[model samples]
Target: MAPVSAPDAALRFVHPDLDRGPEAGLVVAGDGRLALATGMLAIRQSILMLLSTTPGERVRRPDYGCDLHRLVFAPNDETTHGLAMHYVEQAVATWEPRVQVIHIDAHRDPHAEHVMQTELHYRVRRTGIEDSASFGFDLSGGGG
Candidate 1:
């Protein structure tokens, strides 16, 4: 009998619940087939979608997203970044029950006058694995 490789061994022990199934919604694949995000990728994409959506944008779910858009025209300062961080933290915690937020950091982009960078650090609640996501909030009339 052939021995199992290390990678295969690791796959054998993957917790089933860590990747239960595809998340909500569907996307068109490269070949036009419907696809869905799964596991951590799904979580990350959901985070981005939640951040991009503004409060009251969704007709049925009025409170589905972060309030990042409200600061689009605000001054690019610590206060703005602070509010952004707060909004992100609140949204992820409230909407995404799969992960526990570790930290949220926001700051003005050093080279871009109208862009602020926000990074979210979180640990998957079920797996305890940590990951981070970064987003550029574009101001100056450009969408985030």
Candidate 2:
């Protein structure tokens, strides 16, 4: 699917300075400053951030996370994979309203020791363009 290019739509999904520069999330322009992230990039980053977080990891937002790490301990099987897909679907639906989840796929890595891969396909609510994100989680050390 064709993704909408940058600098086109109104500024959306503005995020904190993630560059980790001196100003961190803030960028300095000639006249003023801004925190980076626009359009699809911002939405993508937001999804990754949500995925990276473990539930209760955020200080004040206890319910604002993916908790995908729990799959690390689960037995590599279709049931586990199904649960993972459902979990991601629910989390994304609750946490991010800017995009509609089209499909979710979770599967075990047969070649790897203990790894699970999750693919999420989505369509931007405003643009109607499609995009996807893939995540690989290592389950060896943490749980299984």
Best-performing candidate as measured by TM-score? 1
TM-score of each: 0.77, 0.72
Identify the runs in model 2 with alpha carbons over 4 angstroms from their true place: 1-35, 142-144
Cα shift from native, residue 62, model 2 (Å):
0.9
Model 1 per-residue lDDT at 66:
94
- Top candidate on lDDT is 1
List CA RMSD, all candidates: 9.9, 7.0
In candidate 2, which residue pairs get closer than 3 Å at backbone N, Cα or C atoms, i.e. clash?
17-25
